[model samples]
Target: MTLPGGDGPILTCEGIGLAFGRVQALLNMSFDVRRGEILSIIGPNGAGKTSVVNTITGFYRPQQGTIRFNGQDITGLPPHRVAKAGVARTFQNTELFAGLTVLDNLLAARHIFLRSNILSCAIYLGLAEREDIRARQVVEDIIDLLEMEAIRKQEVGTLPYGQRKRVELGRALALEPDLILLDEPTVGMNLEEKEDMVRFILDVSEEKGTTIVLVEHDMDIVMDISDRIVVFDFGVKIAEGPPAEIKKDERVIRAYLGEG
Candidate 1:
């Protein structure tokens, strides 16, 4: 797509291995996500696509290998620490707070950026008040960007599945992250919802200059949105390249596309 940020990768994973008991979820997995580019990880069901995301975000630590972000070694950092390091993610399943309003859920993500202490918050003045105001402004801007102004006050649990997914994305956006790992962002949405998500993802990349790591099963969407595609199978990386090259890769066609 001829995007910018040609300097180097924003995130790098090398020789990553993860195993749960006898099942190896990943094996010697390695890749680089260039700054300000959308990189898609595509594989069949149970191919450890989500496992890669979890490992990168620190939900699951790799038994071996290292993960680096922006020239810093972030391997094995806890999820909260990862968030604080300017990395954010949306889950394959929506992880919104069921009882909270959309606005509140989005604001909660800004907690990592809050500088006020408990005493200041209780006083409701000075730094605490200023931080609160700024946080709300960020949340409100996200709500407007995602077209969620109509449901800002609505409870998340009462919303439809598609809307809930959008809220999850909004919450991740609230982090103002440098890198965003999106696992199946449009998996269960209608065509229109998927289109909207693709648009928002592109906007986040182009307008905000955010680097994206997308794991999706929809080949059409993946091919359309991804600047580079990585294919995996049974915990092993089979191929990696631009969409057009990946489309005709023999190993990818055999292992992932289910063709001879």
Candidate 2:
């Protein structure tokens, strides 16, 4: 993966700091997520990995820092506003609608683009019906891409963990985001599921040209799929490099082992 030079990164963070009461969650962290590249943020627990994602997604605002996406200063924007800026995210735990079908879950993401008024939308008439059909076609394409055809009509809660994860991923993909943030996408998966998830993630980046900011703990998955990595410890960035160099970093090893 050849990174673009001096063109400005797809996402840039500088001097990011966040706190709740006296406990500081993040401090002076900076990094760049290159366009069309998979950048993984790794760290031991309590190292503020999720804080970074929250800050980026506008779930939490940093006291200090400037966050730029596609060269726009988006610091302290709200989550929905951030999402409208072409940022999409999936939770660490599956946040699927327990009673909704898989297809309905994906359709929900597509609903934002409805161009018709409420009464027309309620009746599903004229443009509203056409938009519904269009949205379903896009959702169908996503179902095909994510291989959710067989279970598309099944209730999401009835699916197993790995499959629910796929639905969550598909939901994010449904939004057709420019930059996607995934938090521990393969955390609770078996080996086969993990491999499948990795393949899908890579496909999304390469095939769709979507930039990804991933937070994953599986070292082998991170090392294998990530183009670059930023290692965090105690809310501070300790190392930033390719997988090979990161593997040899003493600070990273120490942080992983809970050592000094």
**Best TM-score goes to which candidate?**
1
lDDT string, candidate 1, 100-126, tens digits: 999999999999889888898899889
Report, for every candidate in turn, its global Cα lDDT versus the true structure: 0.92, 0.89
Instruction: Candidate 1: give the clashing pairs.
Output: none
Q: For residues 72-119, could you state the per-residue lDDT of candidate 2 as single tens digits?
A: 888999988888788999998888888999999998987666668889
Clash tally, candidates in order: 0, 0
Off by over 4 Å in 2: 1-7, 257-260
**lDDT (Cα, 0-100) at 190 in candidate 2:** 94
Give TM per candidate.
0.96, 0.95
